[model samples]
Target: MDTIASLFSFITWPVSWVIVQFHKLYGAIFGPDTGWAWGLSIVSLVVLIRICLIPLFVKQIKATRNMQALQPKMKAIQERYKSDKQRQSEEMMKLYKETGTNPLSSCLPILAQSPFFFALYHVLSKIASGDKIGALNQQLVDSAREAHIFGAPIAAKFMDTPEKVEALNASLTDVRIVTAVMIVLMSASQFFTQRQLMMKNVDLTVKTPYMQQQKMLMYIFPVIFAVMGINFPVGVLVYWLTTNVWTMGQQMYVINQNPTPGSKAQDAYLQRLLKSVTQHGEVRGRGRKRVVKDIVAKGSDRNENERRFFAGLAKAGFAAQADGTVVKSDTVSAEAEGGAGTRRQQPKRQTKAQRQAAAAQQAKEAEDATLSVEATPEDKPAPSLEKGPKPQAKGAKPGAQDAADKPARPSRANSGGARQGKSGQRKGPQRPKHPSSKK
Candidate 1:
């Protein structure tokens, strides 16, 4: 545990040293014998740090834009292999490689600054508690002690009053009011600055899940900072507020001048600012009116009028239903030919054989209906027609009845006559069947 602690301290020590040195340097340069001087010095330091990080910030912005622009392609890839997890992963990696942009690029700046932020917090806490005055260099500590502006001490403890040092402690009501206000402003500025960046500068193409996660952090981090702000010294709040302002200004400058294409703010700005510029420069006020006239000339208004007429008809219940189902008409002729209760009329040239077969089927159905009517109440359970032939009547003879019960045959006389006629029509002379009969 000690080893781990040592490792952490090793990493944090330089950050802490840098923060302390920066504070002392600002105090010396601005002669922080006044609160305003120290406040301005903190602002200067923030500006200097931000200016130095400008290049990295630009790179991060470009990377973020590139990531956003890739969203459509990424979505396409995801949709294409929605069912293939392995393939989706491989394709996503390949896409990242090709684009030379990481989704993590958006977080790089915050991650880089986290250590410095921690160090700044620690240094502020020390100053606020008044426990590290001797630890600070003699000259810097003395200057910080002397710092006062607007009758408020810069290095005063949370409950310390200017009157106490000036021999008027009994007369002063409160001295921490300025500190509390500065702390609130610090947290508020941070919140609004981050909120503006997300609302205005963030690229629209960033995935919704990612944007939602970022929004969660945006609120969560500010709340955490606000809670922590109470324990921090007024000097720390000054630094934080200055930093937030610098960030806001820097972001505004970048968005106004070099905004990423398709970003929310960029789109809005172009629509409001660039549209008017181009119109005035190129079209001389006639462009917009001419465009509107052309749109009117294209028959859109006529189409809309037609749609309104149809809509009115529908509202009055006169619209036709075109949903693929056949609607039957109430009038006899208007009724569809094959609708229920309507028989289709067949063409009248069917062959005799077809007519006979249809007549037999009808006759069989009539006989079945007659039999069903004649059946006794005791014979309620009828056998399926599909099973086999029905049982014979009790009084019926076996072979003779079977013979009689068979389906009726066509008349032999008519069949023989037809055969004889067909034979007579053959184009050849008939021959005797036997030699003996011929003799």
Candidate 2:
């Protein structure tokens, strides 16, 4: 353990150096006598570490995707070498090598920071026990020893000292309370951050042993941390809690903006995009290289409502064309016009009552037209069945007719004198023929 501690102290010199810088900066600002300075220095250390590890975080994401992509290959190898454990292991390693993937890359960030974590823990433990240790001289150690955050010593542990045991036996002391609260928070944050990745970001369709292990570790790590937290100094607990908070927030942002294609987070992102399109006539991706649009603007004739809506979309990083198409703000105008062409206008927004009322009005008009067609003869006009051929209505187009003005046919009984025979002879005025023969 001593040899390990020596190695960690050397390996994590940069981290310790950063911590000392923050400690001094905060101490100068808030007085070296206050615990807030020391406690917040630990927080600042976490922030610095996380900022430096961003590239590693991005690498971890790429590695996760690479691992997911290799699932099929891994499964095939497993099936091929099911009878031979050594062969399966060798083949899996070969596959990982070929794909430029590291199975352990997911844990790289934490593993890289482990030495720093332990180094800080050792430094604080020594400072709490009145021993001057690595990078921290006697004067800094004296200040650290005096640093009490919320009445709990910065380096105090739950079961560390005789006074702490007596305080536990007696009543609630600031040391126990602070330690317990920090441990709970740290454990909870770790658990939820891991849980969010598994539930929202993971592609459930690609179920593999690696992901299964992750799921198991999600629960396992929290329990382990909770059990182990009792032995960790309060300063170490603060560091871990701050780190967990940073990870959670970073993960949330990644999930919200650039989630895996088939994950629940992606679905949620799409839903948010659709809502934006509906409300503001456009949607834009946040901090994303590629932007997807669900709506377009057409024509410059926008009213106050549309102008306001589009202005919001523009502020959110959507660009509008002169022809009314909206695309990603980062896209060049030539590309936008080429790809995101003019789209059909969205249907006018209407309330449910308005639609219902319009439908009802149409139905009523149709019913009235049917009733008019079914009118009784008593309601008919006199000219509708007149003997004379009616002239077309003035200014009416050819073939146009009005029901009330249409000409009617002559009655058969009143046209007997002009009857024609089937032999093609017209019998005009048949009474004259009868007078010439024998009436």
Candidate 3:
């Protein structure tokens, strides 16, 4: 670590100078020899460096956007010169030049901070060594060495020997504990930042190896940081932890304000913007108006979130215009075409003869079903519809014939003896008469 830090000694003066200035301000509130003064000085330095790198960060965002915009052309170039690597490279360079995009811009912030980062590491190492370096003279180095953060000196490290820790007026236990906690915090912040970028700021509609690789890195990066953090001096850990926290916060702000297109964060941002627009009857900000114009230009190319935005506008009786304005139009928004891209299936057409045949078959099935139901046996037989003459008595009873019609005579059949009932069965108990019934 010392060897690596020493290689960046060219920037040691500036890095130490910044730390000293911050320390002066903090040393007034907290004692000059207190851990808070030295520790907060490192944190402030990180904030200062990040604030200076804002322009680079913005350029990185712009450069990434440009690259995304040029992807189609790049793909076409690749297809055209796929067999010729040299030609493909030439064409790619031409496109980049035409678009005035620097691919390396995305790495500018990290590259720019490298010198300062190592220089700080170098300064902290000097303090730990009890040696003077850059603006950290002997007195400053001594003060830094004596300053302990939670019983661990600012210059102490997790890997330092117990004897070395005691020499710096701290126990090995305190140094390891403090450094371990900082390492964990730094790693956690880095992981969270990566996770948010993957989950919310990236277009997740498509699955690809690159996305899988990023998901894997989301876990792998923290482990890398944790492994590297143990050797970092307490002051260096303070710098790394503060910068990690800063990066996480900055990423959160970007996700909330200006997320990538077609991303979940963009969806949430546009949702809130739409609510405000609907409530106010117009887009509230110039930035939002520009965003709306771009989405309108996308037309069918807009993402599902942008489609939903149009749906909300159309539902509220407002139509989006090409100029990024909403007008109260009765016509529905074309962008809000619910499943219009899909085709509805229609049934096959039938000929007149076929239709008639279907109807006849259906009628035949109905007739057959009716006959089946009617043929089923019932508990009681249906009343007979046919009429027949009544049985006449054997001897001149025929002339007396209409006995069935003689209302004044009591009919023996009505006496409830063995006789034909309405159901054609003997319904009453018949007394076997004394031998007279047989007669």
Candidate 4:
């Protein structure tokens, strides 16, 4: 253990330095005596490491796919060289080189993190023993000693010296409770993370040695962590737990966005996409930086309401037949065609221009109608059946006939008739004047 720790001393120094910086950053907010600060410091370290490992995670996925693609060829090589082990190994290496795929690339992320894991474990273990190591000054060590999470010091362990246990006022029960809970969480997270990769990311079409190894690691990692997690200081446990959670989330994101082809995750992704298009009228694909915007669906860009309307029609026995014509009885067809069924009618909306024009036309017709009625009374000819009797000559009787046929009367109206000749006769109203106006 000392030799291993010494070998990782280079890594331990840097990891310890960064962790202390994070601890101070959080401790300023959460207080130096609070375990939350130390716990958060571990989480910060995990975040930094995972951020750096993003490229490796992407490469790891690519290498894994490349390896999966070579599975058939790998099997053929093994069968062709079944009698010769050395040749088989050589062919495998050649194949890996030609394909630019590293057989160990899939394990690179885990392997790369192992050094940091061990370095953190060593640092925490030393801190627990009150020994200052790697960027941990005496002041920092003393502060960490004072920091307790839930009354359990960040540097405390499941097993502690009696003096140290009493100094922290911590009981075996307390240690057991904290360590056991963290252990369960760590183990369960590791188990599910590996299980997710196995179920969703791995291609099960070919059963190669690589797949068997993956399957083995899936079970082995969880069991190993459950047993070893008890010995871990709370800080180290916090680190591993945080890292596991990060890995799980990262893996899930990659699986969802760019899942391994022919895997369960891909199948699920396709199903979800199909369901999205089926339910909604729009779907989108990943754009730059995976930004997505919905695209209009093909055919009549009918929205969800229209789709539901047609679905309702289908349910009501107005389904379209194979020839694309609606197949329904006359009554149902009439109801559907006449828009008298449960189908909602969309009222046509007139534009502003149309409304204005219609109003102007109506006003013009009203004005013309009023003018026609008024003009009818003025221009219409008077009603006529026969002519009335005309006024007679001055000496004519009240009911005298025309002068051409009736005789002239010698009366007061014509009293000057002897002095007046027929041509110069004095003519007056044929009717007699009133008594007042007789003179």
Candidate 5:
């Protein structure tokens, strides 16, 4: 550990300078020899480093999302070349090159912080050993060595020997308790950060090795932190805890504000936009407008969540415009609310066999009806077959039985010629012969 920290000794001066500057400010409120002063100085140093690494952090986010997006393709490549490890690696590199993605970019913030972290660890070790290093003079070193955070010396570690802890004027138990608590918080924060990312920000619809790797890392990272945390000085633990907290809050902000498309966070974000648009009848913020514009641009290609957002807007009497503005649209709202364009209940399309069967059924019904009329008994009859009235029977009315049994046909116009058939065929008047043949 000493050798590893010494390898980053070049950064020790800068790290020490930043810590001393923070210590000065904190020392004013809390005595210079107190835990709050030195402890907060470590936290401030972490914040300062993280602030400078913001650009790297942003790059890391982009790389992570890009990696997620490329997972399926990567998996395909892997399957395609499983027997050829060299070729697979070549293809992977090609893919990375084409996409301009650096797999290592996801580790940028951590990689960038390592130097400072180790430098701080080295500086703290020197203080506990009663040695002066970097920007911390003997007086400052003495003060830092004497500072106790939660009854544990700031330079004392959980694994420090009892003799060494006693030399720092701290009980081993106190150091272990303080360091253990800090380690747990640090690990817990790390776990929560990754868990939230996996749970909310990632595209849950996709099942990929990328997601699997993330799930593995989510568990792996906390364990690594906890294991390594035993040897970390109290000051170093404070630095790590602060960095983890900063990372968590930073990630949360990004998830809330600019989550990946099709993610739960994005769904939540869209819901918030929908509510705001519903209340105000317009997109209020530029960020919101941008989100709406992207959704509008998706058109019918929108995911389930985006489509739901559009539906919500439509139901609320608003429609998103191409320019990202929401306008009052009674047409959309009415259609959404009233289901105005409800699908017509069209008759089911019959197959050829079904049509034939239907036609036969109708014919059979007509034949039965005709047979029923013809089979009626002759009793009580009033009309005869010669188109004359039947002999009066028992003084019955002459035409009583022949009274209209069916609807009458419509009368044809008098065209001064033989009348046309109800089928509409013309039967013109005949003259003699050729003019006569007609007669």
Candidate 6:
């Protein structure tokens, strides 16, 4: 059993040795005696990783921008096959191919960072555990043991007993407090960094579902980190906090210097940054303070001009007031006068069928009227037996003739009048004129 245990330890020794080397590397670069050194190492790690992934970041930005630009075309394709699920899927794939934009581009930076993050975690954990001193060389192990910042040793166990604390090189209470503070700062800085990227750096026109997914992850990942932070060792917390601060600063620089135009947060961030830069120098010295005052004076003048322009527009009844209410003349001319309640009256509603029927009826009536107006008098039939009073038998009763004649009179008058006094009047025209004469 002892040999088996020794064998297992030997098998894991290389992994432990690598972690020790990483810790030593950090300690050497950032003085092993100070927490600030470790903090700086964390910052350095972040900077190095970010620099390495710069190409990936650029690709991601380009991909996102391309996706946004293709939104209109994609929407059109969606609309074209809204009811065809299979076709929509095929078309979407084709669109993606044509655009050469992958939805996964945004995650490339995170994917690249994951391995480095894991490595850092391992290094910090090993440093905090203080159990694998045999894996490290004598010089590294001695330096690590001497590593203290503000009287708190980096290798000190935060949950150590009172006796163990006294035995340790630094105050356990202070180490635990520092660890807790670092964890909180780590969580907070990560949240803010991610929040700014999501709210400020993203392009507004990207309607891809993946962009929304990325946004959700941006918020969710930070919250997850915050919740899991408590479990991390103080050394790990220090690294995480420093890394987060670097990320925040990096994001701030990117958003302020190269903001997406349609992003509200990006614009605001840029404006704020510009205001800061114009008024204050890189450092806030007394000279920069005076410069800021001058910038403020210029900003005030521009604001005054804008206010005056808006005021003029408002006075002319062409603009809304600051409260969003439009000002208009209240006086009504005779032509414009109406009942006060009339302005507020709701429009009458019509059902679809009713509206269609009304439209059809109107069209038919218009067509008939137009045909009548276009027809020449000669084209219309002259009054004949069809329209005139029927000829009565030689001894027909007057009552029968009167009843028959009454119905036919109006028709005869209309048709006869349509061809009155024409030189080429046909025999049919003469017959209708003689019928009324006979009566």
Q: Model 1's lDDT to the true fold?
A: 0.57
Clashes of 5: 4
Give TM per candidate. Answer: 0.50, 0.62, 0.73, 0.62, 0.78, 0.49
CA RMSD of all predictions:
19.5, 16.3, 19.9, 28.4, 11.5, 16.2
Please, what are the lDDT tens digits per residue for candidate 6 over residues 1-62? Answer: 22332434433444445545455667677666556555454555566667888888877767
* Model 3: how far residue 170 lies from native, Å: 0.6
Q: Looking at candidate 2, what is the lDDT of residue 214?
A: 86
Tens-place lDDT digits, model 1, residues 204-234: 5556555676688788877887776655555
lDDT of 2 by residue, 326-379 (tens): 566644434445443566667899999999999999999999999999977877
The ten-residue window of minimal lDDT in model 5 covers: 430-439
Sorted on lDDT, highest at the top, how do the candidates line up? 5, 3, 2, 4, 6, 1
Poorest 10 consecutive residues by lDDT, candidate 6: 317-326
Clash count, one per candidate:
0, 1, 0, 0, 4, 0
Please give the RMSD of candidate 5 to the true structure. 11.5
Candidate 6: which pairs clash?
none
- The TM-score of candidate 5 is 0.78
Whole-model alpha-carbon lDDT for candidate 6: 0.59
Q: After TM-score superposition, what is the CA distance of residue 18 in candidate 2 from its true location, in Å? A: 2.4
lDDT of each: 0.57, 0.75, 0.86, 0.74, 0.89, 0.59
Q: Mark the 10 consecutive residues where model 3 has the least summed lDDT.
A: 333-342
lDDT of 5 by residue, 231-319 (tens): 88888888899999999999999999999888999999989988888778789988888888988898788898999998998899998
| Candidate 4, pairs of clashing residues | none
